[model samples]
Target chain A: MYLFRNYLLVFNILIFFQVSIFANNRDSILVIGKVSNNPQKHYSYLKPMLNYAVSHMKDLGIKKGKVLMARDNNQMIQYLQEGKIDWITESIFSALIYQQTTNAELLVRKWKKHSPNYYTIFISKKGNDINQLTDLKGRKIVLEDPGSSTAFYVPLMEMINAGLTLEFLHSVEKKPSGNNVGYIFANSEINIATWVFKGLVDAGAYNNEDWKKVDHTPVVFRKKLNIFHKSDTLPRSIEVVRNDLPDPIKKRLKSILLNIENDPSARNVLFAYQKTKKFDEINEDINNELNRARIVLNKVHENLNSL
Target chain B: MTMIIQCLKKINKLIFLILIPSLVQANSDLKPLLEVLKENETISSEQFEKIVDAVDNNDKNNLGIPAQINTKKNDEKELLIKIDNGLKISTYDGSANFSVGGRMMIDTAYYSDDKQPIGDGTEFRRARIEFNGKMYEVWSYQLDVEFGGGSADAKEVFLSYDGFTNKRIKIGQNKAPFSLEELTSSKHTTFMENALPNVFAIGRRVGILYESYQENWTFAAGFFGESFDNDVSKEGDESWGLSGRTTFTPVSEDTKVLHFGASLNYFDQEDNSEVRFRSRPESHVTDTRYLDTGKIKDVEKQYSYGLEFAAVLGPFSFQTEYINTHLERKIGGADDLDFFGYYMYGSWFITGESRAYKSKSGKFDRVKPLNEFGAIELALRYSMVDLTNGSVTGGETDQYTFGLNWYIKPNIKIMGNYVRVDNDINADEDGGVIGDDDPNIWQMRFQLDF
Candidate 1:
């Protein structure tokens, strides 16, 4: 009688734990929003594309994909990993690094203005005699954020190859320009570029796509700033899904995306974005390119360590 | 004629089935009937399908016997027996194996000063329970605890990685490397516990450890700071230390085995708390070397150096070690006190058998097994500790111990020993006249380690 009672007690406890785990796995939809750093300058250009993607979420069987307006990549990656967002459209470089530590995947690539290659340009403020990379030594440059691909990786890599390393010229009080010969995160590219134009920083770096959208180009920057260097063409932004999504659901999502431009049902969605052409298959060919980028990025990291 | 023959075969099978059971029961087989059944043709495909369906649905009578069923049952029985653990539903098979081992000791003593009995004469110092086995090729673990200590405390609870290199990376607390005497397992130590010098010199430090062994050489090192006993508060006070020791046996299958090792240790304490050496000194005569003096203060700076050697020949084995320690304290400006301790101890098996030290195992193999009864051993050790510059007491001492051991079985032992202590005494009250400053004393102990 005692043995029978013990067996029943153990069975009840195990069932309770099993049910608890099952309850924790209940699924829910994630919503995300995106915004340009200079909303007045670039929001008009991005609004249509953002709205179109949201409308097509149901055809993609997402049922309820919500749009949130975050102005930076850090918040996007954080929310995406925490399941607050199911998919993210970010630059290839940012996607490459975030995927290393999270279960996110590259779902689609953005055909920016229908061009696959976008390079970052380094600019200096007006009245600053920094015309070349070497002259920027002992001068402060502003990078939008730590995870920015064109704003951070490109300019940093270019400076390293030219032997102009990241270093401090003098004490803060002795700095030729308050921001000269140092690097600081401006939170947004517009703020970073404005800092350079207003003489708050010596120079600044950002991607060509964002620069093309800037209306005024800061008359001060046009007067003093010079494009010291430009990085190699970087792949455009890609929409990444979670890595552990069910295979069947993933297949359906992929089919819907690859057929988006061809299907009349997805026409309104595709029409919202001007530069988008059509969904393309992502396979070993694209993976090799990403691998090459990773190697280059790792080398740049190693270079930073030596400096 | 063909039809008649087919019918005859069917009738023969029915008759044979009826007669064979009776024949088997009678212990007298009918050859013709058995041959008739054996000569029957295979069943038609349609008939075979029906039989298979019946069997699947649990409707078949199963009159026909299976020859291999008995053989399979016997194999399973053999497997269960091998894994049976005591009376529990346990077994020693490919899935699991149990190791029965322990470390038991006895410390007997005598002192030159009758005023102090530095050694704890109570024997049976330790009895440990050790279990190490495996579930499959990739997963293995060990659970070992000391029973006779103050409480049954866990010593080693670790899972090992055995698939890759010749060495194993153990991901749990085991032993720290500091002193050769400390590293030498208590089960095979010359004395019950380490000497008075060792107690102050080395104590158990726990942390993640990695060890590798190949042929005659064994190498181990670790990063130790946080221990299971004190996990929470030990974080910020991060005083991490590392130790490594290597032992080599040059010749293969030699009666006289040799073991040698060296170790280094350092501790960096945090904030106001300083790292220090913890030593318990033994007073032989009155067992109170310094009642007049206050308790010893914990020091700040700590460092240890050690070397050891052991050899086995025929029925006798010898072990020796030398350790030098330097203590760093704050009260006095950079007062670095260094002292050295060494002892040469040996044991002889009174029984005819010789001591076999297993290289693969960091332990001595079944020792002194008698032909029928049991085995006996006699051992002697002498050690001196100089505390003149001890940085704590400012005293000097020496200890002498003689011991005898009896092995009742491979896993059991009975031990007895007598130790003497001699130390400098400042004063004494004897008939209004002060006796000799240095007094003499004696001590004895008995213990069992399984």
Candidate 2:
């Protein structure tokens, strides 16, 4: 009986020590990333930018910037809720989700790859009879990964608004029942193009930027395919900070990033960071759009969960 | 006999009436049996006709047995091969994607008024097949081989690690980081071939390179050994070099850009290194080089520095580069030789399309047409090279060129260039003192990539 009590006391002490360490380390800036399609590939581009941002914040007791890659959206939400991640850069869809679940606030809009905004474009083979969204019934559509806003959610919401029933399939080869449009996840923009071009799917959807990229949709394929529809534009990407972060650090980070372009020494660092053009302050119109996006995200979540 | 015939007819009628219903229910197989019965005189002609009519009616009414349906299982595994844009094959799990592509360029030139005969003929500029892909999403590789100009060559066979932020480490045969023109892909260059300064650009070499970039700038440096497929070195000697380039863009946008860059190259020559610099009259098909720097002997080390500036404002873009090369001799009391060259060019798009600037390499990329018809571009350039310094007179030359390019598609283009060359009075072009001979050349190329 005495030995058991001693063991319990030792365990309690260890737990207390771990809690203290974690509490002290909470002040360190933690950059969180969700593995969208390719974890390693995405992290490779994010790490340098995170390092540069953290290095500029050394005056705020930010000695280092650490990256924590979440396996999925759910895990990312859990991390935000637990206050484990202090900052995040994500797509509009993910930003909406975090805004609803964890109260993350938008800090700035990142001009990723020099593109400030992008819109979804629905494409089909030139001779396929699918000319409009209504004609997609009973046909299969390929989409980029679920995390992509323009490729997945924007088009999906539009389709839902059109009163078309959608059924998710495990692969592109699966057929849908009559009166329902089948959709499959391609996990990449190029794969979506391939699916539509090779007649594996009746239609495909992605951003206009990808459609124009020669590498993604080569000229040979573009000759045989045509865009049938396009969605409204949305902000490309944004940087967000946890709402509970200290206000001083927030202002300082914003100041540092917004003025990074003006500094000649930071040129190479900024160029390496995914060719980031510059960070701009979020405006009221963007805020309203984000709110609307939140509603769309909620509806999408309900539909997917029910399915 | 009449009574017997009447009895047989009656028997046939009764048999036909009984078998007609079965024939109607049976498939096409029963029709053969009915024909046999009629042939053997077991049934009358009218009875046989009635059976055939019933079978045809049943088939139309879907009452016949499903005509020996040939059902196939369709068990063939779908080969995940895709040829929509480019040829690509991928795994179902999205872990691997591979693509095969190639490009070809056919060039022809006609030169006039050359005192020292310049060959005017047609030649294949580049015919290359390239294979590139990413493995496990973090490692990427490219293997390119060229078969043109009556010879086969290897180009850009390298593996790269892109798992770093805005940075990549490449190891293999690749262009040493030195000049913007040399780094930019050949398919995207503004002219058919680079200017005279390209002779000192330190082309592709076997090397290990590191590259990183930010929004408006890029920095690349590498340590390189002798070029791939170079001649075997003598015993106890080998060639090696180091080169680096940095570029900064003050203004970089889709339609506007201002770029500035600098590069440095240093190399140690092997024993008996005979280095020479020469160029033709802005044409690749001509065998005669008007500006020839004869072999410089007793060389130990060579270094080159270059300055570059480029600006793009909508349909108008301008670019200029100045390069200087110096050689340090190994023998004492032998004066070192110095050479310098510069070129400036400007281009305008008749269709109002701007030159596409690739920020990754700080160079120009493919020009995309805004309209359906296509885009047309016009360019003019002035280049000069001086190789006569400190008694090693390799001669000097100046050239002016005008170019026209029609981009019919992203992968297909037709280009035409008219060049005028003037060499110095003491130029020794063909191993002899051939006095200043002016030449006017016209070149054209049909290029395609996939």
Candidate 3:
């Protein structure tokens, strides 16, 4: 009788486990959305992480998972406004835009590229007499493409705030006017450092993370460059969700992301997700941060449009 | 805090409205306006509760899913073809990929005269066709069949799931997670034939395996049944086994690696069981088995374990493994026997190409040629297997091999090997052939796969 009872108990547990694991209604699903120009690469990184998260959320009204890719911030903002997306992982600049245009709020801050925060640093070759933002008058400087936050917006904002006028130079050989600082797009950080090192440009600016990377700042260039200025730090990246998403789902997602680093098994998935280190909760201070980002984004947008 | 403050402000307005209805209790417009913006409006709150709940739910679903990555029509989804080591097709969404490939190895050899004649001739060593694919992003499968010996043999037919963070679970016919060289694909092995100790290796079987790995280590364990070719008719239970393997790499990269691993297999016999151990002189083209244990009956179980170490430094790399097998008889007296085998080899690539190591699977992968002509490698190996124990002499042999491999392409190569075999007096193949007979063997192979 004892063995029979034990077998019956085991059989019942197996049935319960099977039913819980495989039973899924079509009504409920978790959608992780991203604003990306490169959908194929982003999908590779998002699919595995979504599958893992959904596996643990099966009982919490999430039976399936899907990825939604938007081509730009405008498309993603429209996605959130239309309720087409449930969650978004984006940079602080994009997150601020989404917050203003839709009923979305910050859920967590992601340590993207293993950095919790990033700021721009203005650099010039050592002994070039370019000691400060004021020294770039009548000289050429290189910044990454217009889409970049660190190399373009932060650096541009700092120069404009310092009362220096910038000129758009189509060629690196072109010099600025007597009262202007000339700037050109290098297309990449490597080129930014190279053009400045070759004396084609007087100065270069990019994120501190790239400044330390060998691929972006070669060892040979690091010895020749001097950092003259550093911009204000901003949250590296953020994960936002619908403001009125059910509390249970929000709670579960927050818990999962916060503990992703605690489990050694998640190391591979985390590394693949843009080399994310960990997630920190977004407190009420996010309000002030977004407000400031709003001002900086507008100024950068206005300045770039004029150029 | 923001939501609370906003809710409080609305509550204050509701309070004023409650007073206003009293102040203007006779006004009809005020009555409807108060009811329009309702949340617990001076009743027991049952009726207002339902209305508020409905409004909240309507606001909650304000955002609904529209089009997504999988929104394209089935026929409109873009498919991309890639040609690398193999030809592969993948969807633009990165959700699915498939590849069709095969490998062929043709061999020829000559055996020196010994006490017994060992026949040598040209033959096809391996002719394989493989179909592998991944679907739904996390699910993958491989189906491979070998038609080398004028017959079809199932090899590595399995469906695998990699949905977990860094782990994988596979089911169906696959390898039993034992032996580093056994886990390495045959097309990538340096020599024309495996070292003699492969006699202790469990090549492939029907099994379910769970494997996980990181940047520096790999862990695999599985339970297995008999091979697909084991067509035995038995009234009693069939044989089964458990296998596990773990590998650690202090340094892991494509050109540089320091790897150490160990594996074990525990197999149980059926009610009526027998076992045999035999091996050739490390050359597949020869049809002579100078070492044989014949057959032992009343075997209860078998236990085997192996230790492996491998390293690659730039153009030079080396690998070594030692395996031991212990057998238990049903009589349970002093009849238990132990046998062992070990092999070590080293290779140098003269054309600046390095051996590739895959940390995820804890195995060596295909080597690519650096030069247009090809990468040439010279290698040497020493291997020995002893199957002799008290009252049961299988045989003992030592073999030395020299190899030259030319990798013309990533998936194409030619190999030449020379081997010298030395046997003990007990290496008589159960007295079917002369003992203490030494032989020299020469072999070459042309191989390609895609």
Better of 1 and 3 by TM-score: 3
Q: What is the interface RMSD of candidate 2, in Å?
A: 16.5
Worst 10 residues of 2 chain B by lDDT: B69-78
Whose DockQ is higher: candidate 1's or candidate 2's? 2
Better of 1 and 2 by TM-score: 2
lDDT of 1 by residue, B189-210 (tens): 5445466557444445566667
B-chain TM-score, candidate 3: 0.82
| DockQ of each candidate relative to the true complex | 0.01, 0.07, 0.10
On lDDT, the candidate that comes out on top is 3
Task: Please identify which of the two predictions, 1 or 3, would achieve the higher DockQ against the true structure.
Answer: 3
* Tens digits of per-residue lDDT for model 2, B1-450: 989987987787687677667657756356788788788777768877867766654553341111222223211111245664357765322335577988899999988867766778998999999898767645888999999857779999999997666679999999988777777788988889888888888988998999987767899999998778887755646678899999999897777889999999999987647788877767899777767778887789999999999999878999999999999988774688889999999999887778889887788887877545778999999988887787677778888999999999878899999988888874666356475888898999999988
Model 1 alpha-carbon miss at residue A154, Å: 79
For candidate 3, write residues A230-299 as lDDT tens digits: 9878888999887766788888988999899998877888876877889988765655665666788788
- Candidate 3 local Cα displacement, residue B355, angstroms: 3.0
TM-score winner between candidates 2 and 3: 3
Q: DockQ for model 1?
A: 0.01
Compute the lDDT of residue A250 as modeled in candidate 3: 85
